[model samples]
Target chain A: MTDTVHSDSAPPNGALPGTGDENVTGDEKMWTARVRRAAMRTLPPDKLLPDRQPSYVASWIYVFGVLTIAALVVIIASGVVLTWKGPSWWHVSKVGLFFNSIHLWSVELFFFFMVIHLWGKFFMAAWRGRRRATWVTGVVCFVVSIGAAFTGYISQQNFDSQWIATQAKDGLNSVGIGAFFNVLNFGQMLLWHVLLLPAVVIAFVGLHILLVRRRGVVHPFPARARPARHRITGAATVPDEALPSSEIETVLHKDPEPVR
Target chain B: MIDVVSASIVNLTHPGHYLHWGFIQLSLANSIVILAMLAVFVLALVLPFRSGRRSRR
Candidate 1:
C-alpha cells in the first residue's frame, strides 16, 4: 500500500495549525460542545490515528510498545475468564486451569515488553519536543502495572500468596497504607488486581497514547548525523528530518553507537 | 490439565543457582529473564527493520 499521509514533519507544537496550548474560540459556550471542539482541534481524527509516521519510527525498537499493549490484551482477556470461573474452580477443572496459566503468562509478557519499551524510549529521549506528559504517563502506567502484578500475586488462593501477604503487610504497614491496601485480605487484593489497578493502567495508557498522537514522535537526535568524510570534508550532514525514508534508514543502519 | 506449578519439577532436577546482594536477590531463572530482556533490547536497536522502505510515500 502507498504511504497515504506525510508525517507531521515539523515539531507538532509549532507546525500544526491550532494545535498549540491555547486554541481560543467563541460562541460554543456549552460545556459539551466546548469540550468536543477542543478535542477536535487538539487531535483531529487523522492525527489521533495517523496512517503515516516519520521514517525514523520504523526501527524494531518501536515494536515493543505495541507488543506491550498486545500482552496487556491477553492478560485482560484471560483474567476475565479466570475471574468468571472463580478462585477454586481452577484447582479442579482443566479449562479453568488453562485460563489461569494463560493469565499468568500474559502478565509476565506484559512486564517484559513494557520494560523493553521503556528502555528504548529512555535511550531515545522520548520526552523531547513538548512530549513530557507522554513520557510521564508511560512511567505512571509502568508503576501501576507493578502494583497490579503485586496485588495479583497476593490475591491468589495458595500458600505462596499467603507467604507473600504476610511478609508484605509489615512493610506496607510501616508506610501507613496497609490499612487501605491490605495485602492480607484476599477480597481487597483481588478487587484491586482485577479492577482498580487495571482501570488506572488502561486510562493512563490511553492518555499516554493520545499525547503521543497530539505531539508527533520525537525527532531523531541531531548528534546522530556525522560528517561524511569522503563526500565533502568538514561539511556536516543534515538531520534525518529532511531525508527520504531510504536515506534515513541508511543513516540509522550506519549509526555508530546510536544509543549513548 | 497439567499443573503450572508442577512444571517446575523439570528445573528442580537441576537446582538453580541464585545471587543475592544487599536487598536484591534472584535465582538463575530470574537472572536469565532480565538478561534476556537486555539482549532483546540490544538486538532491537541493531537489527534492521524491513518496513523502513515502507515509510516512503
Candidate 2:
C-alpha cells in the first residue's frame, strides 16, 4: 500500500489560522491555532488562570530564601572575577585576595540562608499535592550543593585547603568513593565545583520554582471545629494566620481540645 | 616494578602529615553544619509529599 501524505501549507478551507475554524482542513492548521491561543493566553489580560498567592508571605521567616538567592548572585559575580584571573592569581595578588575574600564571605552567607530556607520550607510543610518530584529534585540539588561546596573549599590554595584535601581522601577511600573522585586533582575538582555542580544546582532550582508556580502554595491548616461547650464558653478560637507561628508550641503541648 | 617505583615516588613527594588535630576539629565542625543543612534540605523536599499524603488520609 502506498501512503499519501497531506501537505497543506496554506490556510485550509479558506479560513485563516487565527480564525480557528472547525473545518480547518489540515492538522497543522488546527495545532497552530491551538498553540497560538495557548501562547496568547500566557500573555497579559487574557492570560492563563492566576495561581493562589502563598499564605506565608507576611512572615519574616520567608526572607531567608530571597537572601540565599541574593548571596548566590554575589557568589556568581565573585566567581566570575576569580575565573577571569585564573585560579592561581588569588593566592598572590592583592585584588585577587579581595575577590577571594568576597567569594568566601558570599559562600558563608549562601550556606547560612540556604540552611534557613530549607528548614523553613520543611516546617511549613510546603510539599503537598503531587509535589514529591519537586521535593526529590530539591534533595538531589542539596546533595549536589554539598559536593560543590566541598570541591570549592578544596580549590582554595590555603593551608586549610591542602590539609582538608589530603585528610578527606582517606574517609572517601574507606567508603569506596575515592576511586572515582580524587580530591588531590586540582584541575578536575576546580571545574566540577565551579562550573558543573553550580550548573546542576541552578537547573534544579529553576525546576523547583517552575513546579511551585504551577502547583501554587499549600494553604495553612484548616480551622478546628470547636466543641459545643467551647462554642458556648468564652474560649475564643485561634485564627488561621497564627498557624505556622504556633505550630511548634501546638505540637509540643497537645491542646485539651482537638485541634481539628 | 611499577608498584615499587610509584611507592618510592610517593615517599619522596610526601609531606608526611597525619590528619592533624586542628584539621580534625575543623572537619567535625564543618560536618555538623553540613549534616544539619542536609537534614533541613531533606525535610523541605519531603514536606510537600507528606502534606499531600496527609490531606488524602
Candidate 3:
C-alpha cells in the first residue's frame, strides 16, 4: 500500500521533470509528475526565482562549490591581516611573514576551486534558461581572477616577481592595456589586487549565484528515447557528438543500466 | 660628560642588529596569526555542510 502511495508521488515514468520523459501511465507516476510540475510552476523565471532547489550534477562533486567560496573567504581574511601589518611589515616582523605565506596558499586554493567550478557549470550546460548573462558574467569574473592573481604575483617582493614583471610587460604592451596598467609598479598592483579586483570578483560571483538560485539546475540533456525538441530551449539540438559523456550518462532518463 | 653624550648619539644612529631581529620576529608573528585563522576557516567549511542535513530535520 505504501509502495503505491510512494509511486504515486513520483512523476510519470518515475522520472523527475527536466529528466526528459514526457509520458507515463502508473497512477503513482502521474501523482509524482503532478507534484513536480506544480513545484516548477511555482518558480517564476521572470525575476530569477526558481521554484525548486538546485540538485547536484552528482553528489560526489557538489562540495567543491562550497569549498571555492570557503577559499575565497580565507583569502580575504588573510589579505586583511597582511594589509593591516602593511607591506613592509614582512621585513619587520616574524608574524608578518607567516601571514604572507598563508595568503599565498589561500590564493592557490581559490584558483583550484574556481577552475573546477567553471568546468562543472559548463559540463552541466547551466547557461540555459536565459542564463546567458550569468554565463558571460562568470567568464568576465574568470578574466578578473586571472588579473588579480597576476597583480598579486607582481606584488610579492621576490626574485620571481622581478623576472615575471619584465617578461609580462611585453605581453601586456602588445594588448595596449599594459601602457596604462603597469605590472612593475608594486604600489599600484598591491592596491588593485587587494582592493579593486576583489570587489569586482565578489560582485560577479554574487550575481552568478543569484541566477542559479532563480533558474534551478539546467535540465539534463535529453535521453535517446526523448527528442531534443522537448527541452526548455528547443531552438538548437545538442548534437550526438556534442553532448558531454558525463552529462549524457547522468542526465538521460533511461534506467541506470550500462549504456554498453 | 662630553664622551658619554657622543656615545649615546652614535648608538641611536646605528641600532644595528636589533633592527634585523625585529623584522624576523614580525614575520614569525604574522605566520602564527594566519595559521590560527586558516584553521578556523577550514573548520567552518567542513562542519556546516556536514551538520546541515541533520539540522534541517
Candidate 4:
C-alpha cells in the first residue's frame, strides 16, 4: 500500500508539490535554510534596524558606544591608506605622515571612548536582563583591541616602536608566549595589527552589538519617592508617619526592573 | 627662567621632541595627538543627547 501510494503521487521531476500548510511549516529543510529561518526569527528586520528606542535610551552615557564605533571607522580607513602606501612611504612622505597621524590619533580616541563606554556599562550594570554574553563579548573585544593596538605600536617603525618592542619582549618572554609572539618581528606584528586582530575585534564587536539589540537596553533605576495617598477629605497627602519604617525602607531601596 | 618657560610654550605649540629619556622620546606631536584623543573622549562623555534635554526616569 505504501509503495503504491508513493509511486502514484511522485512527480515527473521528482520534486514534491508544496503543501497548502507551507506558511505554517516551511518547506525548506536544508541546514542553511533552517539557520536562515532561525536568524530571521531571532533578529527581525525591524529589530535589527529599529526606528525607535525606549525613552530611557535617550541618555548621554549611551553616546560613547557610538563614538567608539566612529573612531574605529577612522582607524580602519587610515590603516588601509597606510597599508597601501607601505611603511617606508609613511616614514618619509608628508602625505603618509599626515595619514599616519590620523591613524594614531584615531586609535587613541577608539581606546579612550571604549574605556569610557566600558566603565559606563559597568556602573549601569548593563549585564542585567540576561545580557551577560553582551558584557563578556564587549570585554573580549576590548582585550582583542589591545592586541591590535600593541601590534600597531610595534609596526610604527620609529624610536618609540623600537623601545616598546624591546620592552614588551621581556614581558612576553616571562609569560612563555614570546617564543611564538616574537614582538621583535615587525612583519608578524604588522600582519597581526592590520589583519588578524582587527578581524577578531570586529567579529566580537558585531556579536556584542547583536546581543545588545536582542536584549534591549537595561532600564534606569526607579525613582525613590512614594506616591501620595488620598485622605478622607479627598486631599492627596504623604502619610509618612503612619507607614512602617521597614516598608518605607524597602520601597526606597527597591531597584528598577529590566526594561522589556 | 623666563627663557625656559617661553621655550616650553614654544615646544608645546611646535611639533618637536619635548622629553627624551634614554631611547624613549615624547614629542609635541605625540602630546597633541594625546590631547586630541582626550578631548574627543570628554566631549562624547559630557555632550548632551538630542536637543540638550537630559533623560528622565
Candidate 5:
C-alpha cells in the first residue's frame, strides 16, 4: 500500500529479510540490488499479473493483443524443435514436417493478429496519455518481424527458398544494400533468421509489453451522446455546464483496473 | 522388407509433388504452407475471446 519502505521495517543490514536470503549484502552499489529495485518500481508483481480490468477493456478488439502473444509462443516452441532437428529434417521426417507446419501456421497467425492489433491501436489513438513509447516499440517490433520472416523464407532450403533468394538478391542489389545483406547467402540468412532477427524481435516485444504494463490500457472514447444545445446570447451551447467538468474529473481520477 | 518399409515411410512423410489450381501452380511444400495460412485465418475469425462469467471490475 505504501510506495516507500520505512527504515523501521528495514531488514538487518547484511541480509534481505523478505527475500529469505540470509547472506544478502545491503550495498546500494550492487548491480543486482539496483536492478531489483528498479524492476520492483517499474513493474510490480500486481501490474504484471492483474486480476481485473477496466470495463471498456472487455471489447472484442482487445483480444488480438493476447492472440498475437499466443501465436508467438507457438512459433518459438516449434522454432526450437526445428533448430534441434536442423533444416533438412523437416523435409525428410514426418515428425519434423508436423513441427514445421506448426511453425508456419503460428507465424501466419502471429502476423494476422499483430496486424489487427496494430490497426485497432491506430484507430483507438493508443499513443494518448504519454504512451508514445509503447506504440513506437510495437511498430518497431512489427517491422523487425518482417525481416525475420524474410530471412526464414530464404533459409528454408527448398525450391521456394531458392527462387525467393534469387529474386530478392536483384532487389537488394538495385537498392545497393546487397553488399551487406546478400539474399543468396544461405548461411547468412539462416543465422539472421534463427538467431539475430528473433533476438531483436523478442527484445522489442518485451519492451512493448513492459510499456503497456506501465501505462495501463487506454480508456475508451467518451460517450458521444451530447446534450441538446440552445441559443445563449447568440451563441449555441449545451445547457449542461457540468458535462465537460465531469468528463475532466473522470479522466483525471480514473486509474486502470487490474487485468482479469 | 526394408524396401517396403522405406517406400511406406516415404509415402507417409512426403507432401505431394505438385498442386495446380487453374492459373496457379505450387510445390507440395508451398501448398501446405498456403493451406496452413488459410487455417490460421479461419481460426482467428472463429476463436472466442471471453470465457466463463464476463463480469467487469
Candidate 6:
C-alpha cells in the first residue's frame, strides 16, 4: 500500500478514490486521506458540533431530545455499575440494588422522554426539509431501544424474568428468530441486553444526532409561521401591532436557514 | 417484605386500580403515566420558553 501511495497518488483520471483503483486522484491515493476528505465534506467541524443553534430551538419541546439523551447516559452509567456487580448481587447488596433501581428508573424516563420527543417531532413533521433519514433513524433507534429494554426484563434473574421469558419464547419461536435470539436463555439475554443491543442503539443514536446536526432541526409548518412580509407601500404584510406578542416574538427572532 | 416508598400512598403491589374500556384494560399507574406524558407534551408546545438572550450570530 505504501509503495502505491506515491505512485498512485495522482491518477490520470480524477475519479472518486473509494470507487476502487480506477479512480485514484492525487489526494485519494491513501484511504486515510479519502476518509478525512469524506468526513470533512459531510461533517465539517462546525456542522458536527456547532456553537450556535437556530432560534427556533428555544422551546421546551426542543429540550426533550436533550433530556432523552441525558436519561440514556444515566441508564448506561448505572447499567455499567450493575453489570460490574453481576445480576444476583442486586438482590443481596444495597449498593448493587441502588444502582439497579437507578438503571430501571432511568430506562423508564428514557422511554418517557423519548416517546414525548417522538410525539413532538411527529406533529411538527420532523421528516420535512430532507430530514427523512434523521426521522427514520430516530424511529429505528426507538424500536431498538424497545428490544434492549425487553432483554433487560427477561434477563433480570428473578421469577418475573422467568415468567416473561417463558411466555415470550413461543412468540419468538413462531417468528423463527427464537433460535437466534433465545429469550429463555438468561445468560444469552443478559449478554444481549448489556452488549449487542446497546451497541446498536448507541450507533444508531449517534447517526441520528449527526444527521440532525447535518440537516438541522426541522422548521415549523410553512403556512403556520411564514415570515412577516412587507408591502410596496411600506406597510407590513401582517401588521406588527396586530400580531400577538408571542407570535411577534417568534417572527422577529428569525434565524438563518438551518439547512446550510 | 413490603416497599414503604411505593406502598405509603397506596398498595401499588396489589392490582385492581385499572380502567376497563371494552377490550382495553390498563392499570391506573400506566394510565397516569400516559396522561402525564401527553400533558407534558402539550406544555412543552404551549409554554413560553426563556429566549431572552440575543443571538450571538
What lDDT would each prediction earn against the true structure?
0.77, 0.65, 0.65, 0.74, 0.75, 0.79
Candidate 5 A-chain TM-score:
0.80
Q: If both were scored by TM-score, which would come out higher, candidate 2 or candidate 4?
A: 4
Q: For model 2 chain A, where is the 10-residue window of minimal lDDT?
A: A251-260
**lDDT (Cα) of model 3:** 0.65
lDDT of 6 at A3: 40
Candidate 2, residue A214: CA error in Å?
Answer: 1.1
User: What TM-score does candidate 1 get on C-alpha atoms?
Assistant: 0.77
Instruction: Report the lDDT tens digits of candidate 1 across residue range B5-52.
Output: 677555455557989998888887889999999999989988888653
CAPRI-style class, candidate 2: incorrect
Candidate 1, DockQ score (0 to 1)? 0.38
TM-score of every candidate relative to the true structure? 0.77, 0.60, 0.55, 0.69, 0.70, 0.79
**Error of model 5, residue A226, in angstroms:** 3.3
Residues A1-260, model 6: lDDT tens digits: 32433355644454344445444335355677667667777988888888777667777876899999999999999898888888779877877778888999999999999999999899889997689999999999999999999999998898889999999999999999999999988889989999999999999989999999898887655334334643221223663345665554355335643221
- Which numbered prediction scores highest in TM-score against the true structure? 6
> What's model 1's lDDT at A216?
69
Candidate 6 chain A: worst-modelled 10 consecutive residues by lDDT: A226-235
What docking class should model 1 receive?
Answer: acceptable
lDDT of 5 at A254: 55
Ranking by DockQ: 6, 1, 4, 5, 2, 3
lDDT of 5 by residue, A1-260 (tens): 22334454556464444443223334544676667667777888788877766555665556878888889989989999999999779988888878988998899889878877786788789897778999999999899999999998888889989999999999999999999999998888999999999999999999988888888777655445446643221122345443574554365335333235
CA lDDT, candidate 5, residue A240: 44
**Model 6 steric clash pairs:** A9-A26
Q: Give the C-alpha miss distance for residue A165 in model 1, angstroms.
A: 0.4
Mark the 10 consecutive residues where model 3 chain A has the least summed lDDT.
Answer: A251-260
Higher-ranked by TM-score: 3 or 4:
4
Candidate 2: TM-score?
Answer: 0.60
Residue A226 Cα positional deviation in candidate 4, in Å, after optimal superposition: 6.7
What are the DockQ scores of the candidates, in order? 0.38, 0.06, 0.02, 0.20, 0.11, 0.39
- Please give the lDDT score at residue B45 for candidate 4: 57
**In model 4, where do residues sit more than 4 Å from their true spots?**
A1-26, A223-260, B1-48, B51-57
What is the lDDT for A207 in model 2? 73
Worst 10 residues of 1 chain A by lDDT: A227-236
How large is the interface RMSD of each prediction?
A: 8.0, 8.6, 11.6, 6.9, 5.3, 5.0
